[model samples]
Target: MDCTNSKSVLKKLSVALIMFMFLTLTQGYQISFADSVALTNSNTVTVEAHFTTEKIRDGFYTSLVVNYNILDRSNIKPGDKIIIKLPDVCRDIKPIYKTEHFSNCTVNGDTVTLTFGPNINEGVQGYFTLYMYGNSNIKNNQNYEATVTIGNKVVKANIEGVAVDGGDSYPDMYKVFGTNFPVNNLGEGIIVDRNKPVPYTIVVNRGRKNLGTMNLKDTIPNGMALDTSSLKIYEVSPNNNYTDVTNLYLNSGRVNMNYKHLQIYFDPGNMYMVDYNTFVTSTESKYNNTATMTDYYGNVQGQAVAILGSGAGAINVYKTVDKKNIGNFGNQNIIYHIKFDSFGTFLKGTMHIQDKINPKLTDIKVTGTNQFTVKYDSATKTLDAVNDKSTIEPGDNAEITINASMKNVKPGETITNTAQVNGGDTNTVHTTKNPLIQLSKVGIDNPNHLLSGAEFEVINADNNERVSNIVTEKGNTNILITSDKPIKFELPYGNYKLVEIKAPNGYALNTKPIDFSVNANSTIINLTAKDNPTGNIKIIKTNDLKEPLQGAKFNLVKDGKVIKTGETDKEGILEFNNIEVGDYKIVEVSAPKGYEISKDTSVKVNKDQTSLVNIVDKNILGNLNITKIGNDGAKLSGAEFTVEGPNGYKQVVTTDKAGVATLNNIPWGTYTVRETKAPIGYE
Candidate 1:
């Protein structure tokens, strides 16, 4: 009786332990996990391919290769038979088929190689398949794994079944043959005792290198034939998102083929535009094609429209040692990239087994010009593409532009922009050298500092007088100096000398030489001046018709007024503006030969408006026959005097373009003529 009681307790304890073990396997992990599996098994496989039982328009199908190291325990060779079963739930998919080849398989004394399908690392039996309608994307659930008998021994393994509808609930490794879906929560290691090193099954790739820019492609290397154009791949890890690196949509089934017929590839889950180039190469001729064949079943060759990398996401990370991508694309038999830049990034998360149901989804962040930077964080294993600082100035406020792929974020998520000034105090200022400004100071300090609360007096350099002209325009300007102090002063707008300084009680003056500049705030007048007749003359109202006109009024004006004025006579002209050293009455006109005048025309006498005068011969005096005073020495040879009526003209007898005719119609009044116009070209 006691023995029976002890046995009952032991049974209870065993059951509880088993139950605890089951619970732990299912619930112990808060995150997803995975590992690379090495395939080196020479197991006989039963390949059964079919479509889902319940088909809408069409049905989908997939296959799996069951791997087992059973040769050591029993006798099973090529062509040997093994019986396996599927759950009654899935009747549509058949139960058995024939095994193809022991791919990458080896009976190296005891260990075998698993080189079947695209995945070559881990032990894989064969690819289970599904059949569906034309151009239809379908999948199946391998319902259950029933007991299978191999050489009189009942072996147990989860049956690779088929289910077309439950993609949302299960992993669909159907895209890549022999590949497993769902982040491989299981880790990788030798299942057998490592101490007893059985012949190594997976060949550690010893060749093929990464070209800085060169990538993995199959066609580059001749002698290799792969099917890349028509393939459907699955996103097994990282939530099975179907996309090439750079977000470019790609056929889920095709992995790129490269040199030596090696299988190299880019990631469907990385920044497609930035980092989607892939390649593969090898040294050994025999292993070259084999390695590629074992990695991916098909080859890739076609136009690549890799979309640009996501702005907010970090560079994609891949499972590459040296240069080869692990498991072709995944563990055992798969092809893909688990890549991202290690620098300037911050986050790490593994997503797996994304299918038509569960796909890869990520939210990326981008920033405005000079707004923020990115960094990596190891503890949080997730990329944090967030703004690190604000790029704004207090006085010159700015708007931060956030360029992110949140377009899918229908309603924008609340985000913050935190800017930081590395080394600065107060408001920022954009100096001459730097266009970007930071807050450093608010406003200027001192505006004006007067002497005893009185306006500063203006001084003229010409006469040292309290002048009004020198101190006009920009009469007063405000001056700000520093932080908390300000002063006022009324000053003029002119160049000044630092004579002295005066300040209020207890406040220090601007000790640095206080030479400041003011602006000219007064309005200025500009005059465009011209005269009807201008010429060289020495005296007013002299020469020509009358030597001196007694009562003619004239004034020289610049801008508005002249500092001097004079009179003209029958010559009907006057002079102004050009005042220079010369004769008593007038001066400054550079006279023609035989005509005495200064270089500058000063008092050119002429009609104020219009006048007339009687002409005399050149050697004759004005109304006085002054030439006869030379004892009749003059002959009037150069000028023979002539007179006309009020309408008849001389010299120029008719009017021309300017409507100015020669002197005519004297009417007994003093007449005028062309003043100092020498014969054309004589000057």
Candidate 2:
């Protein structure tokens, strides 16, 4: 057995001896024990008193040794008082009493009060010695308890030691033990040894002279169940130990559940033994089992108590997201927790736990206790936590945390992941779908017209802030739109504007920002912009008769420059198309075959507006020559002619020597010629 187990055994023996002696003597006596039994005396000191009698000539030298042990030396000061009220047995026997390490001690009735001085260590000890009458007829197998008072603390003195009384020392008692529940009951609480098998055993002393059938009854502790098939019996031969007699028991199947207890019957002459394994099923830390033994006729033999350690050696995991259920379109943080608990046992072995990280998570970072080493593998997407010295004591837990990020999740898609611990349990979490926005570029004039090479930017019109990198949004990567293709964005719920940043060549830039919302799933928006107008101008060239004239050239001028040059067609129309809205001047560069050049005409062109200007040209003049002869027509000299206009205005012309006269300027109209004077007229 280990040192801890040895201490536990010694403590049990001491308690049994003291209790048996006290109870055996006071069984028929009318004695008043202490009314109340408190667990602790004071925060600074714990007092224990033990009584032992030495054989003397006329009486027994009963010594009541009160050991004052300081639990916290720093908390005690001088002048502290300790009062110990002895059992009724010391009432008439306290003849001579003395103490050590006490400033003063006084006896009053059955109580002794001692005042403390300075110089007290945590391991300090003090004793009180006294004498008792030999004829008192003290009984064996009895325990005498006292009441101890320290400062303002009051408690019962539970100090117990093995008391022989006189005889009755039997060395053939059976022992029951929990192999896995190793503890030093004398020092403090239960101390568990996790490396041992989880089993309970009953062992009988070897070389027994004569033994009868032994009956044992044990109740299973909470959170533990006995494995019926694991029950095994053994018979020791004094020479060869651990001989298996498990098959000899015809009633091995009788170890079934009997109100959460186990009972066994065995003949004790051959040093019989029985053991079974217990399975732990709960998280409770401590387990206690009490076993009682009896002879065939039901005569009480001995009782043994077993307090086992259970509950530890477990791992648990939990996962949480920063965005809760909604998984944003982009990168989001996911947090995980890993916990290891030793339960009611001490874990001192190499422990390793691995978690398969979901492929959707990346950039994993683990932070926790320095005792564990954590590593992540990208190929397998797993995180392994291992340690060589995982010293986790009972009732304590070690936890580690991991933080990771998940990226590029789409809208209406959930990102779910599961985290598991090795030889333990698993937990899962997922995200919900968020809203999305779809934007398309369009022409205002034609809804079906796909406008290419138009770039747009989406911004929060409320604050004029550009939205990007939203955690749950479908990643805010580059949003450069092109080629009339519709652009989709998973954005946070808000009001936004789509502004045209750049437009195609020969197209007007839409300076207006289109406002929309992304409050619901699949929110659709289309931005419309109109192209600048390409207007036209028409010029008609005609004579005074207001008819169409051909072969007329005209220059269309805008802003003092010739924008286009065109001649009138067969219909006498000079037309200019696909021109911007502005003031223009149309000048006739050349006239038709029989018309003069028309003057410049000013006109203003607007969007989808047609302007028409009419230019009238007058006909040119002609010269005529005539000769007056006697009987034949000859070249005339000094001939005069009159040209009449349509408005009744006349012009006179005279023919010169060569019988030629020219009319320099004349209007195109109906005219009549009259010979006013003829030199040598022949007609």
Candidate 3:
């Protein structure tokens, strides 16, 4: 009985040990599962983000929706939280305090923490609408991505279709959003002329959201001044149509202007449009204007920005010659006037003016008002002037005078001088003296018939010296005067003679010097040099016996075109008078009754000389006869033969009843005759 008791005790102790071991293993497994829950929580949750609007303007507020789902509730506990890291460009975040799934929501810098509620369940889904302001650092027209942390797992969410800087929005107008609608938004700015008003348009409540007691404020750019008289307001409809409500707003004192700042109050009704004008007061290149909308409590709702650009003002420089300063040969003491007019903006600081004086001008002197300091560099022929202290106001004019003497300049010679302000806006002026001469070379009897390729030398009659530096119209030493235009050149005020060095083709050269005079009284002197044409073609036709052969047809060809056609007279002589002097060809079209045509003769006619062409023709004739006979000397009547001659000439002949074949009118050359067909039977 004691042994049985010991066995029973041992079994009980073994059972007890087994239970303790099972408990230890179960506890260890529970602890391991609890530790792994944090790591596996990442796979139990899903996150996604997207922008509510298709595109959000850069540096503006936009709505971002972040959706999260709890896939496995066993891994997620009441105290667990999901942390969403917002993008860097998202600033001024306005997050919801609480949602259905999360009991508390808090933001710390760029992170948003959402704590799970006590009643968290499996497959629970919720979303947070975050109103984030995209800062200027955000790249335009690009998708944004953020990271979400759930336990030890990190998930990525992307907000696509978001753009900055008015991408896919109105041009130059950055549109910002409020909780429900758009607030103060201005259109793109434009450049206007100085003192001219620039128009501006602002649209409010474009989303048609109704909010009570809305207040709008606009701050004009520093360089612009508001025009109160041009302010107008209109009520807008959902379809984007407008109704003028300026009078009602003005009478009710809803619109107020405080210098460059403007304010308007509207009772919630419909969207509104505001129109106004501002004049640019400064010469700044760019101006940025901002407008904001707020509730009655002064909580800012939305903001918009408009940019203005003032185009560079035009600075015009005009240079003119003083008409009173004149001389016989050229302007001995020429005076030039340069005027500067500032069109749209004031010229400040040192306004530089440079005048490129003509090389022919000497002794340069420039004078201006007390504001200007002038200097002249004779070596470079440049005059420089500067306005250092005084400012040239817009639409105001500044003048400077330049005095110089002309050297080595002939009469009718024009000197062009150019001046510029600030190395741009170049202006030019020209001065000329009197007594211009235009020499024309024409036909002797017809003044309208001009000639070309005539060379001449001008000599000073008093000094008997050849004149140099003669300026011609074509800038060439050899004058080419055409029928439509005459050659003009400038000479000094004195007596001069033109000696013809070479005349045009077919025109006689005038050896005598053509005398002319240039004086201050006459502005232009027209002279004509007439040339006598030479072209007479005489053709003498004769026979081989050296006797005159009459009735010979001839053609005078020039450049392959027949100029004249005639037949020789009874004396075998043909003459063409008044023909153009050039190389020509005389071709005999047909010879007299019994003679053959002569070969073509080339001849050249000289100026004022007759060209003689003597052509002789031969009256020779050749005949060919063929007789066909049998072997016994009997006549064969039906024989046929082919005759070939010079110049690829060929003919066929047949024997007649007299047994004879003949070929006539063949040129003087060797010939070949072959029997093509024999009489009747003979081959």
Candidate 4:
């Protein structure tokens, strides 16, 4: 009989046996079938067959054992064949038998044939194992049968299906899951974002079966679209080791995809993983996807499911200014606060922010962003910020602050600033300019009296340069504020000083400069400058001649008190500089040598002019000699006399033995002499 025809007949018999067993069970009768069968030859060959594992899973490898024995050796011969035909669900059979009994073993489909060698002996009892895989065509949760023929003898064995529903065995031949955007194995599901991508993995041939020419179809769920460019394939071993095979499989046209599904075709001799990404396209709350793996015959080998839930909500952005009004000058800070709020979902990856500021603003700085780093571009007057490591969960808010300066901006001009978050939400803030300075001038001696005709210059203290563009109420830079009118002007925010360039008539010029600062918070400033009334005094000294004296010391007395002291120059002029306007006396404290001191000369000092006083100091007269005799030209000693001279001068002198009493260094005036004591016998 033809061996190929025998395999067909054996399959029919196995099906009949199953049907008969079913009928017998229904009729309440029990019958037992032998595991061994006798051959139709004189040698009395017997064959028995069974599976090593009682239960086998579909799409997995299992071992089928067949044993044969020759009771009598009379009919043993070389070239004899033993054929084993497995059920259609079983494929890729590999035979393992002793070489002494079989010359070679060959397989066709699910059938294994063994040829006997010349060493065949009587009573030969050896078992051969056939390693095979149960294809997807097999019915699940039932017994699978196979037939064996040894020298025209046939035997059959049953393999029970694994109880997959009871969780006794691994069910699916493939597994699918998501990570990155929605991490796998997390107790709580990850929230999805439209800007984020979700990575998916489909593990095909998970049982490590040699399933030839299979296809995997992964259905993309609603609210998402497949990313074909991100698809990759990896060959995975049973030990969990991975080898990248993306380029090899993709270049060979084995992987393909569309907007809705991704398909991969491969000969899975080992386990393989298909990785790809999907972009969220909708605001749907949940997303579910399924991956199905099928063999060459279009039968589903296994299926797996993956789910992604929750989606991001709209983002809100707001901005505000710390100060609504600021000075136009430099050195003033303008703070802007920006906030971002997430209504729902989790936001990850880099968050970006951009702010465009007014051109007049300078020294831009960013702060208060704990999760972000910021940079500023002066040329563009913009701030760029990014956060790479932080995440924003549902109902969370993030804040950032920006600081800048207002410089060279015109008063009353408004500044507008706008900011955007993540290239989406935008917000704006505004600041107006308000700056002024008021100056009033008064007399230092009389603070209550406001002086006029005072000229002032505005200077920048930072650079020591004269400032321009000053807007005063009088439309001039002169700070000549008086009792009736005060000077008011506008200046940029910065450090500055006021200089008294010119003083009012009759008032002394002030040389000291007053320092001040202009800023945002203090926009208006009030100032007061003081001056003193001043005058000069001139004195002329001579010795009874119309000539100016050189060495004459004088004291300027006010209210009988010495206020100032000075010496005359070659012109005999001693000026009491910048004297207050009041009544005073110019007294000659000491005259030039050989001249008498002048009397206290009454004078007055006035504003903006000099007062002149002339004094004539007569030259010293010849020494005066007096003699007191006893009425007879005789010399008298110890005679006391009183001498009186000009300018209320009086002195007492005693005569010497020569009867001479002298008066020296006296002014030109009439004198009176009177005897106060006489000699011993004279009166």
Each prediction's whole-model lDDT (CA): 0.24, 0.53, 0.62, 0.64
What is the C-alpha lDDT profile of model 1 across 1-683, one tens digit per residue? Answer: 00011122122211111111111113232111111122322332222212211222123232222323221212234434334443343323321211122212222221112232221121112222111121132234322333434445444333233323334431111111122211110111111111111110111111221212222332222222333332322222334343423123333423343222323344322211111112211111111211211223243222211110001110111222122111101111212111222111111111111111001112322222232344323333222332234311111111222222212211112211222111101111110100110111111122232223212233433354543332122333322222222222223435432322332222323333323433333212111111122222233434343343333444443334444665554553554422321222322223222223322233323322212222121212122111111124422212222333222533323323332333322333333343233222223
Q: What does candidate 2 score in Cα RMSD to the true structure?
A: 19.5
Query: Could you list the CA RMSD of all candidates, in the order they appear?
Result: 31.2, 19.5, 31.9, 28.9
List ranges where model 1 is wrong by over 4 Å: 1-345, 348-572, 577-683
Q: Which residues of candidate 2, in runs, are more than 4 Å off?
A: 1-181, 186-196, 204-211, 238-240, 250-261, 297-538, 550-557, 560-570, 574-581, 587-600, 606-610, 617-683
Q: Candidate 3, 425: how far from true, in Å?
A: 11
Whichever of 2 and 4 has more TM-score, that candidate is 2
Error of 4 at 356 (Å): 19
Candidate 1 colliding pairs, count: 138
Q: Candidates ranked by TM-score, best first?
A: 2, 4, 3, 1
Show model 4 residue runs off by greater than 4 Å: 1-214, 219-262, 266-287, 292-328, 331-333, 339-440, 444-506, 509-527, 542-550, 559-563, 569-572, 618-620, 623-683
TM-score of each: 0.17, 0.39, 0.30, 0.38
Score residue 296 of candidate 2 by CA lDDT: 41
The number of the candidate with the highest TM-score is 2
In terms of lDDT, the best-performing candidate is 4
Q: On lDDT, who's better, 3 or 4? A: 4
Could you tell me how far off, in angstroms, the CA of residue 677 lies in candidate 3 after the best superposition?
99
lDDT of 2 at 545: 72
Q: Compare candidates 1 and 4 on TM-score and give the better one.
A: 4
Model 3 residue 495 CA deviation in Å: 6.4
